[model samples]
Target: MGIITAGKYEGQHPIHPKARQILLDAFDQGWADPTQISSQGRQAQALLDQARESIAKSLGLKVDEIELWGEPELISPIAIWGAPGFGVSPFIYGATERSEIIGMRGKSKQFFEISVDIDGAIDLELLTQTLQPNSIVAIQSANIETGVIQNIKAIAKAVVAQNAHLHIDATASGARFVKPSYWSTLHFDARSWNGPSGVGVFALKNGARWSNPLPHTRPTRAPNSFSIPLALAAASALEHWIADEAANSTRLKSLIERVRNHVKQTISDVDIAGNAESTLPNIISLSFLNVSSEQLVAELEIEGFSVASGSACVASALEPSHVLKAMGLLTHGNMRINLNHDVQDGEITKLLALLPGIISKLREN
Candidate 1:
């Protein structure tokens, strides 16, 4: 039930079935080094270009602007910290930004972290006040665990007024939550569209003031290290998602709202962590007072359901979720649900029916 379950936020989504075949086909035809001058090399290069072109069309970016970075985790540092400008600019970001972006703070010349409210929206006034002409800002369009979306439009306006660069981490929501015109650099995860992992795509807007921080012989060198077949798979997945899953998004949103409402009405002392109106459709976060998230997760598993805990422990310690902590929400007794295309409405109904009893039983102990 790993990829088959509704609890899909944890690991690599199994590559879309159609994309899997495309990957196999690509390996057959695209295995040669695209940089070589042989006939086979030209064919492989053509396929790679097509892959980039397909993904670029999906993201509303030019073909030349995209890079096929090998790892999603590494792309953050490459796009954000790799910029020479960030070294001297005033760094402004919400405290709830992903660990990859936040971890770069020590290197910034001047940085300010604006705290988020209970709903996980970045503080607008404080953020606006902090922006400078050479400011560098990193903001996630939505939180991965809690699905809280920031007001990118308003944030971008402030940054633009001060002639600052904005790095938008659209890893959680992808193009659905992004505004291309507002970003100096934009990143998206192929895995978000059930594409292959390690196929992270980041775009450099034309005329952006940045260069590869990675050491290179030439000052104008760029990096492209991902597998060509995987790039094809990622593009295929995006096409499949746009054709098949985008239409179902509305129905899923409706079901998600019903879960939020049902849980709120039937349970007490439960903190629904994100703003209902502004969050991503595929993720939900809930915290039950007086219950162990570990217990709830285990109990739900026993009942043939799969769910994850917010602040999932690492190295045997219950790591606090920076998103929840920054929002001043409960850090424990939390459960996160991530819906996939295969998760049926019936499964949602069943989970809704099972939650109250399992939660009560866990609390009673």
Candidate 2:
């Protein structure tokens, strides 16, 4: 099949050619333990430090504040509830947050979800009312499914006014958006920006009032010894993403609007989710009137175009998307399209050309 499914999900991008070369070149030293004092270990330590410094520079953070790990899902809980010495405080998140954030309910001291407007933005008024001193407020820079960017600066200000901490998940935003200066903590996945998988970075601002929640006998608090080559590759990929950010954003925004406008004009009983004015240029979530998301996905696949029926993070789930539900949008027949950073204009045009006929056929039957 001549398939084009770029932006299928996070880390789904084929490793950048430059990142692959970096990984290969560092393969030997990457295997050595950076903590050991041996010569080889010292070389590995140099590589690791370089990688960390590169990432820190990219995020505008100090080197010591960065922690490298594999899982993006685990970062939220650890940052929100695991900090040692910090007393359990209320955990608040937007209703449109990833399931992982919403799932923190049982694990937190007291978890609450703030409502989102139709555009999938956190209701700032409700959030203000819900804040408690020492509370941990988790908000993503951008919604993975809807691509709605949050007002993190405002949110962080409110959280701080209440003497609470804010954790911003920049995984979906990657290098596309800058972190708010007032954010207490932030995290991003390497794979989100066309880097290799199996690496993620978490950053805690100095004086952020967080400690490792996990019982620690080890000198280091990070859970895993990540692959040094992977870290280097990730940093390299991030550099490239940042360099291309402006052009990519402009091109992708134009292409996304093309599809959005075409679908609205040609299709029946359709609703486009998220506020276009405040969303990432890459992702769009659409709902159909009488189509089964599964069947529509299958049909699209047969046509050599791969699309997601719901959130890529929870594609295996049978229930409707929590993001759409929170926004009071139709949850059934939902499809999320994420345009790849390198996607061509022709690819988008091709998809738009096919959608009307495919959707009409599906609805008629």
Winning model by lDDT: 1
Candidate lDDT (C-alpha), each:
0.80, 0.79
Best by TM-score: 1
In candidate 1, position 240 carries an lDDT of 85
Candidate 1 runs further than 4 Å off: 1-11, 28-30, 219-221, 312-317
Give the poorly placed runs of model 2, Cα more than 4 Å off.
1-8, 28-30, 83-87, 311-314
Candidate 2 RMSD computed on C-alpha atoms after optimal superposition onto the true structure = 2.2
Candidate 1 overall lDDT versus native: 0.80
Instruction: Residues 283-363, candidate 1: write the lDDT tens digits.
Output: 888988888888887778877777767654511445777777888888878888877776778878888898999888888
Tell me the TM-score of each prediction against the true structure: 0.95, 0.93
Checking candidate 1 for backbone clashes, the offending pairs are: none
The global Cα lDDT (0 to 1) of model 2 is 0.79
What pairs collide in candidate 2? 82-213, 83-211, 84-211
